[model samples]
Target: MQRVVEEISLKAWPAFETINHRGWLMRFANGYTKRANSVTVLDEIGLDIEEKITYCESQYRARKQNPIFCLLSFTNPEVLDERLATRGYQLIEPSLVMGITLSERSLNILPIINQETLNDWLVAYHKLKALAEQPSSTHHMILAGIQSEILFVSFKQNEEIVACGIGVLESGCLGIFDLVTSPMQRRRGYATAIIQGLLQWGIDKGAYFSYIQVVKANIPACNLYEKLGYEPIYEYWYRVGSNSGNEK
Candidate 1:
């Protein structure tokens, strides 16, 4: 059902390297993020399911990275999920893939968008999450590899970046990623403003649909997306490989 836009969605997220093992798709993006470094499109084609799974596992192991299977709700064979569960793979980040038709969306607010603002987003993301002092090189790679039309938006207060987000467009399907606001700026509608700016940017560029992935545990983000008319038509989770899979 969502396959049409899903293909475009997948294309928008260009991985650095991809391998096909008998119709299964595995992507590697320097292990910066899970979605870009996971196995998906587990099609029941030439190889048996177990064989495909084994190949996926071996490939990641050879690369010295843990394998992650993205299990989608509408997956064919219906039993794929069960097979993964039986293999000691733990389910993680049961996330909602919310999307909405963008034809009806409108916002009058302006966004401060350009390549230069990426540093602002990086500062906000690192500070708000309280992550390590040094950032990963793969993050920069992932951001730099975006081939489609994109925009980096940031809002400032008192001359400091308070909120930031990014929008990407591919074949009329716009994807929003890495939307983060300063911890001190929460509940001030800064996040909402960023979302509105992103949406309007996409719409003005001829986008008619938008998609966002939010973890189910994020109540506030889910509520905000719902208010924007984005519904979770389907969900997916990562089948962690018991190794260094990004469980969250």
Candidate 2:
């Protein structure tokens, strides 16, 4: 189950470049989101774990990025995390993969709009969360790189967007991402409305399950998902080298 979710997630949130060394997949995306730029260890337990780590560090260093390793609870060679810690890597962003089985449910979708163009969505999103020119550009690249079916749903009030989220549908699962609500408009049920609508869309498309990745420290987000019937599926965290900055 972990492997399946990880595979779908990689496809849902793609990287600009991916290099598979031995077994680990090293991703790079101009230092955008850590998820897009970190190395992910799947099911391979190749020999020379130390050598592999050095190779990954070199690769990321060449790209001017701090080395980051994303370790899942079920990652192979179980000692990888300990080995990384011994090499001066610090743990960060302990997060959970939450999921729920989709079923029939009444949805109160707010006055939301489905963006037609990437620019349109970005414009509305910028209104909710400020993004500089460079990050805005990189975010656009990441979103445009997704090949699966996507939904850019935004909640509007008085003709202005107050909250927004993205739904990526693939392999009978809906992977939710980029859920953010305007600071002043939060706790107003906009997020709940958007989530209900997204889940309904997934069910309409024959999806059996829906999932989201949230940082453990985000209490409101964790609570929101719980109220929407999502449960913790697995935990993953990043191990950042001494030189790497924890961007995002």
Candidate 3:
């Protein structure tokens, strides 16, 4: 299952690159390749492992200007992990890549948002932001960009924002990101409603497919996604490292 997940993750690299907001990239001797924000691998030939580590650390330090850094994978690259540990970096949590076919499921949630309810949407996002490892700036920026191209459907209870989701139209598919519900709002079907609302929006936009990513260890979330017809598409691991010493 792990290997299968890894392969699927590798397959989604292109889509991941297209949706990434940070514009992260990997520098090579010949040129630079766009880096996968949530997951990627270090593949450097000619240079020994140490040299590769040095290069990646340098790149990571340079990219830290954007705030938090993410190194995602499905398996442990011991060589890289050890090098990173020698520095000040620490391994964070693992993430899962879950996906579903739009045609396989039906969407029937009504969107309850309009220009007058924009503040409610922002409040909901802020509430969910507290649950993420990092702040929500990147997500906020992405949402801002997609507003013109996609529908931002949300759900509220008692006039309080509880759940929100976004659907982006790309290459005949709807890529769903930042589907979140507040801790206080769980177990009340708000998440399901939010996803359904987004799916309905996607269908309206002529999208034929949909997909999302979640952490592997988050069993409750995995169950929720599976219950909603999402299947395991891939898995990714996050490794952190710093540039303090050791050249390849």
Candidate 4:
């Protein structure tokens, strides 16, 4: 299940550039998001863990980025996480990979506005998330890199977009990302509406499973996802080197 979800996520939120160093997937996206700019252990075939770490660090340093290692318990070397910590890598953003099985009932939910234009979706996403210009530009590049079927959904109140989310469908699975709601519109069920809408659309398109990645510290979001029947299937966290200036 770890490998399956990780594979789905790699496609659901792709990086602008990916370099496979033996068994590690070194993803880069101009340091926009850690998920897109970290070393992810995808296989156990590679030997010489220290050598691979040195190589990945050099690669990230060449681009002026501090190397970040994203570790999944079952996929990474058992000692890698500890080794990173001893070398001054900070553990951050302990998150859960949650999923729910979709059924015919999800199809009955009403759909929301499906923004067809990538620019339009980007505009809405930036506004809803209040992202700055530089990161927003990098976000655009990352979203543009997605190769699977994607749904850019927006929820509006009185014709004003109050919430937005993205659903990427691949191999019968729907991966949800960047679910955001306007600050002034909190507790109004806008986010809930967006999730339901995305699930509806995904199920209509033949998706039988849906997953989301959320930080453990986000109590509200974790509770909401729990209410929606999403359960934690696995966990992953980023090990950040001391020099990671813009770590997320």
The most accurate candidate by lDDT is 2
C-alpha RMSD of each candidate structure in angstroms: 3.3, 3.1, 6.9, 2.9
The sequence of per-residue lDDT tens digits that candidate 1 reaches over residues 117-175 is 56656666676666877656777678778899988877777777777788889888899
Best candidate according to TM-score: 4
lDDT per residue as tens, model 2, 75-175: 65468888888888889999999999887553444335555367777887777786654337888999999999999888888888888889999999899
- Give the candidates in order of lDDT, highest first: 2, 4, 1, 3
Per-residue CA lDDT of model 4 for 134-197, tens digit only, reads 3377788888889999888888888998888898999999998989999889988888888888
Q: Report the number of clashing residue pairs per model.
A: 1, 0, 6, 0
TM-score of each: 0.89, 0.91, 0.66, 0.92
Q: lDDT for every model?
A: 0.78, 0.86, 0.53, 0.84
Residue pairs in clash, model 3: 25-35, 50-248, 51-248, 73-237, 96-214, 96-215
Better of 2 and 3 by lDDT: 2
Tens digit of lDDT per residue, candidate 3, span 136-227?
Answer: 44444434534235555677788766778665666556666567888877888887877777777667776666677777777888898889
Off by over 4 Å in 3: 1-24, 27-39, 42-49, 63-89, 104-120, 128-139, 145-148, 243-248
